[model samples]
Target chain A: MMSFVVGIAGVAVFSVLARVMQSAARGTSPVAILAIAAILSHLASVALGIIYVPQFQYWSAASIFSFGVMSYVFVFGAVYKSVSLEVLLAVAGHPDRAVPLPYIVGHQVPEIFRGRIQILIESGLVEQIGSTFAATAAGERLAARIARLRRMFAIGDSGLYDFPD
Target chain B: MVGLVTPAMNFLPGPAQTAAICLGIALPLLLLCYARIPGIRGAGSRFRIGCATAAALFAIACAVLPGERRIDDVAGGILLLATAMLLVYVFWGLLAWGFTLTLLTTLAQAGRPLTEEQWAAAYTQGGDIGKFARNRLKLLLGSGMVAVTGDTIAATSSGMAIARLARLVRLATGLR
Candidate 1:
């Protein structure tokens, strides 16, 4: 009966943790929540193990505790590194393009023409600008250019283009 | 009074019972996944049928297994192996679903509908922040579940070990 109770608690703890992580990704400070959850869950599991499982002696208890700690550390570290990198890139004024182009067109193109119709709004560039009509025209032009370039360079049909095609 | 209770009395229904419990949990989840996922429907009905058949077979096997010996010695191993394979497929499904969700969300946020190629390209990059966020959340949930389940198993096993040792010590000391 105690084991069953512990199992239910374990499931609840993990479920809450999952929801917290999702919330964090949706723009919440999830790291602190994650850390707290990990600690609480680990401790709860250990306490329950001690009560219910006769086999979880001193050595096994120590091992399990250490494993839990290590797992928490690893997960937290990975999340921190990835989230920090994403935040930094976002802050650095990178124009949010769905896909990366080889020439940094979103950033560089606007700078190149200074103030000539936003370059993004220019003919054959609208596709990258996120306007439907412009995107379609730009896409067609890009496809043609890519086909021409590939043929001119005798490139295989690998679909390689200087821009995202 | 506790000593008067037989060992068998504490042992539950064994392997067959455990398998039955898992199947009961898994079947509904599998059905939910199939019903909600449009991409899977478009890909093929065959896959869905195969999964349904597999789930039924597993359920029947669990129900028919008479005791711990039949379930643990044979069926449990096979089930574990199959579960591992299903997990791999689920991982792929999650990744694809995550990518699609991210792309759609971004486009909606930007107040536009993405073209087919753009959508395709976005998914191929595998590094969109929104998509990454979704995938990470899924992984976190998955790992968290494993950790919790493992803890419970470890705790239960430990308690059993301690009880056995106490019994042995009592026997040696002639105190029982």
Candidate 2:
């Protein structure tokens, strides 16, 4: 239990470290950064525990560390490109710290749209050709797999937020 | 008399340990079952139900598993199991409600190139982007993250709190 707690502390430390290092390595994917940080953190934490503590459970420390890192990554992924979050941030950033709803729907949402398009194009999943855009083979394969999962999960492919009945 | 420490040292699990293992295994199966329930509509609600089901099962297992209890083991197992649920939900949510993902899926499903407008139409099931915008906005409003009065929209106190947390997450994750 002590080792496990130590591991979680390591995750906390390394996640913040990764955030600081992100600026220096601008091109690196956040997931990659987090993965590397998690491994390094676990290693450092467990190593210190082994050298310092006479009785440290390696597997227990590892199990808790793994879960903590995964949870952090999950949260990072959630807020990464959240449209609703973006809207809230915009309003929160306002000088008056308030804005009109139409301003968000009219301006911010479209901006988000364009940003998403840019991401797809840059990621090589989709390409803009003339006035039209098409998905690459990689994109199609991923889309197909997502489609399958959605079907298995009974989720609609539309991706539109459905109001709960 | 010879004292032997056989490998069969702890063949039987304590009650909490048994319960933890059962709940861990049952969590995924519960999600699969809930997926088939038509009454659970939105992706958010479906994920919530899965978590709720897992929690309830864990509680029941705690009650029913027969033996001495190891509280720490049970707690650790619950954390591990809950972590798995959160991870799966994150990926599943990405596939379900991710904006960029939907765009790519729509374009791929089209079988040909589509204009920006065409893709937006396809994304919203023939409705304009406004429909999608309203849907997302409804989430923000419904969650009490943001409120609108007349033409103006403002972040509520909770919204501001959430906004701070979001920024903190962004900074901590090197997103900003």
Candidate 3:
């Protein structure tokens, strides 16, 4: 019975995490917020499990479980946190250029409307209109064309990338 | 003649049962890693390979260790400690890498062609990346604590359930 409960709870926890991740992806909340939520939920589950199950009282089981959970949580939180920070840095137009500005900028834009030109401008990472300026210009033109196509097809924001029926 | 009835033994998994439970836990994780890691290139590949190797080594160590050892026993406690240490080590490495990535990306976006020296200085200073990484690390570490506690509870409950089910089966078969 304890196992069944744990299984059910595990499923629930993962489901909530998936939703949280999706929300983060959609820019509903910052990645940091999502990480916090995931961590809290996981902790809650662990507490509940310990309270209800005696076998977990053993040090070995508890230790292994703790380590596994910690590892996963740390990895997820760190990765997302790092990515978000990079985005902020790129946007600030700093001189140091700590991260790969292009990748950071690319992530900021929505996938369908993304382009090198917009990324460079919006991210504020690029210092000058160098040789890559042409590529940026081309990307801008492409984006404009795509936007025009979307308007012509009456596509919604979500449907911008979809083929016209 | 019937033998004397024995008191029920509860709360511990038999050797075979414990092995099965551990394997169940490890197998899914391995499969998940395998599925998600392929097709990643470059630095990502290196990270994946490192994680995989660590996981593999840990799993092997766990397998080779004696089974059915009680946590209260010194040997069991030592094994558990070792496992915990390894897990922490792997997690820390991931966190460091993640922070590094975030820092690099942010600098790149700053619109200035930064020399490596400039980048290094910015990284060392409490620049945006540094600040963000600090905040993120705290959040991740906190969340990790929660996750670890929850997983331990869940795994223990599951293992207990398996032991109970086995007990029931033994009774049904009139083995005890």
Candidate 4:
């Protein structure tokens, strides 16, 4: 119980630290900020546990801490820029909570598509040249590795949910 | 007084925690084995099977391991295994289905510069961006987050609630 309490306290510290860091540095990636904070808090929690809590099982503390942190990250990632959530939010924000399917199909989805392309470009993975896009050398290497893994695992590259055929 | 306050220190892991550590290590090895098996087709199914196998083995280990079962030990073991599963799933999901990663892979496979139209086509295997939109819409509709009425879509009541929750999460996570 002491370990679990300490683990949760670590998570709380991570949350507070992440928010502060994000507020202080606007341009930094949230995921990276969260990672740094999580590591720091986790180490602190373990150290404090060892110093204060008698019978503090290392694995017990680690397990609870990992679960808490991962769950936090999972929720963060899901709500970050999920397209389905974006669509839902868009419609829900509308005056009538509705939108034309064509508007979504034509305007919103393409905007999202372009937004992702911009992200890739910013990440230096893809390059833009005269209204066309191509992968950079680094991007090619990564893509090749991903392709190999997909082939090995028989995973489709479509990136679409594989509904029953 | 100090001695009365300080409890006994035992840093050793419980039996179930030991079992969890061993089974957690075995999960990725099991996934590698599953990759070689043609019977398991999709990444999702294969991963699910791997997790199920690890869980079954953990149960077996708990039952067979020579230690009196304690609730805390069993619970800790479960949490550990769950953490491992979540970690591996996130990594595997990124490699298998990450949108940005797929976009990169698609462009790299193209071997040349592609216009927006060509890129979208390649991304969807000859389909337009509409296909991608429909795919996402399918998820929203399937999950009852939205309802389609001929040409328009509306968020359901539950959808609005979820949207509100998502907004709260975004605010809390400092994504705004």
What is the fnat score of candidate 2? 0.64
The DockQ values of the predictions, listed in order, are 0.03, 0.47, 0.03, 0.67
* TM-scores vs. true structure, each candidate: 0.29, 0.88, 0.31, 0.94
Interface RMSD of 1: 22.2
Q: Tell me the tens digit of each residue's lDDT in model 4 across B1-176.
A: 45333444456778998888888888878888898898887788989999999999999989998958988788889988988888888878887668788889999999999999999999999999999999989989999999999999999999999999999988887887
Clash counts for the predictions, in order? 14, 0, 16, 0
Number of clashing residue pairs, candidate 2: 0
Worst ten in a row by lDDT for model 4 chain B: B1-10
- Alpha carbon deviation, residue A68, candidate 4 (Å): 0.3
DockQ of 1: 0.03
Each candidate's interface RMSD, rounded to one decimal?
22.2, 5.1, 21.5, 2.2
CAPRI-style docking class of model 3 based on DockQ: incorrect
lDDT of 3 at B114: 48
Residue B149 lDDT, candidate 1, scale 0-100: 35
TM-score order of candidates, top first:
4, 2, 3, 1
* Better candidate number, 1 or 4, judged by TM-score: 4
For candidate 2, write residues A29-116 as lDDT tens digits: 8778777777788778866666554456554555577677878877787688788888888988888778977787777887888899
Q: In candidate 4, how many Å is residue A59 off?
A: 1.4
The global C-alpha lDDT for each of the candidates, from Candidate 1 onward, is: 0.38, 0.77, 0.39, 0.87
RMSD of 4: 2.1
Best by DockQ: 4
